[model samples]
Target chain A: MDNSEDTERIASVLNGDISSFEPLIAKYQPRVFATVRRYARREDEIEDIVQEIFIKAFRKLATFRGEAPFEHWLMRLAVRTCYDFLRRHQRNRETNLSQLTDAQNEWLERFHVSDTADSGDAVAARELVELLLDKLSPSSKMVITLMEIEGKSVKEIAEIMGWTLSLVKVRAFRSRAQMRKHLAQLLKECPVTVEPIKTS
Target chain B: MNTDKLWNKLVDEVRKTPSGHSVPHDFEKRIMDRLNSTDAHAKSGDSSKIRSLDLLWSNLVNLARQATPNDRVPFAFEKRIMACIDVPLEVVDGLTLWSRAT
Candidate 1:
């Protein structure tokens, strides 16, 4: 939806026409789901977070000053909500290296055998990345997800997160370091069996 | 392989993974229900009571956290807890929606 339509909808909702918010929800739910899915794995958790985002947008619609597109404002709230979700669930997500599934282990084993090895197993790579992410502190998880996985620039993340550009850059750097520490540990700790290459 | 190279490779692979999850079938409906109920609660003037109950639940969660060995006790957990229940309204709203959704 365009900015003027968004403004009209916000005005309508603020004027007590609650169903006016449904169009906004329809327009943004996919993007919001994609973003929230990065922070949560379960269907229920993703649903709750998405519901919370829209509900929050509905309640806080009055505060949206229209300086930016409604999408930007809503997405900022969504990212922060995901950050809060991460903090709340971080305890349950404490990384146990032992919890690494066979797929993730095999992916690490392949990477260990050869940097040039086929990284064709996208599922395993994704799982390994999530395991490493679970090991990070919440801020690091948020920053790294935005920067690396989502491919958002520091400036864009700063805008989304309401952080200083320097802070975003600093956090991005530290999150990378933290990820490296975890990755190195995984490399050291994960069992690897390299099959010998047969020469004809 | 260098850690940087491996990290970059892994991120590349993950980004290539399609974001396969569509929004749930009835998510919009669930959200509207939650919003409607929250509005009802606010209008019914049960806001303060809901907030206190929500704050109490948050304190209970934090109390449970104190049992974890390495976790820091939130410096006088009881004294500053109310300050931390930032979205108490949502607790009631979330519970109401969750029960209905399930």
Candidate 2:
């Protein structure tokens, strides 16, 4: 929807017409959920974070001027909310290096043998990466999630996160270092066999 | 750290993690329910305040509206304010006068 429609709906919501808020939620839910999915995975957890985002957005609706499209404004809120969630819960949810599943082990083993491997599709890759990423601190997880998983450039991530460019770069560097540490540990657990993929 | 081939492979794969398009079937309903509950809470709070104001005013009608709350408040406070209500308009300031009347 356009800016004026958003303004009208926002006015209605603020004016105590509660149901008018529904359209705004419906229109933005997919994008907000999709963006939030990158930060969270559990069905219930995702719903909570998504719900919180709307709650926050509603509470701060008065601050939203018509300067930007409502989606753009809401997205900034979504990203910030997700980041806040990680900061709050990351320490409590810390896990040791988890045992890889048989499927994961099989993928890793096959991957170990393939030189310059492009064999595994996206889903398997994402699963393996997410498993390792769980061990990183929340800030590192966010840096890597945006940089690699969401395919956001550092500058873009800075804009989305409201951080300086240098901060994004530094976090990216630390995130990469942390990921490499995880990979090194994983490789040690699962070694390569004698026959490796032939390189060009 | 070495730029290992594995890291690149993994990064490329994760970058392919798809963004979803499907929304929950009841997404809008969930938000509306939350908003409705909050609206109800605010409305209830306002109604309760109005109820309190009505109660305060009804007590005042027996005491007469001319009694300013600042008038010599007796020790019983409410009873004193009420007692002061019936006193002569000239007896506005003295708790001593209300004590004598009692």
lDDT of 2 by residue, A85-177 (tens): 888888677544446666666655555454233433334445566666677887888887777656689898898888999999999888776
What stretches of model 1 exceed 4 Å from their correct place?
A116-119, A193-200, B1-102
Index of the highest-TM-score prediction:
1
The complex in candidate 1 yields a DockQ of: 0.01
Clashing pairs in 1: none
What TM-scores do the predictions have? 0.61, 0.59
- The superposed Cα distance between candidate 2 and the true structure at residue A162, in angstroms, equals 1.9
Candidate 2 segments whose C-alpha is farther than 4 A from its true place: A2-4, A96-98, A115-120, A191-200, B1-102
**lDDT per residue, candidate 1, A14-117, as tens digits?**
89776677677767776787777677877778767877887778778889999899998998999999999988887887667666788777755664454333
What is every candidate's C-alpha DockQ against the true complex, given to 2 decimals? 0.01, 0.01
TM-score of 1: 0.61
The number of clashing residue pairs in each candidate reads: 0, 0
Model 2 Cα lDDT, one tens digit per residue, B1-102 = 566988767666765666674445577699999999999999977665444333322222222222211112113322322233234357456887888799
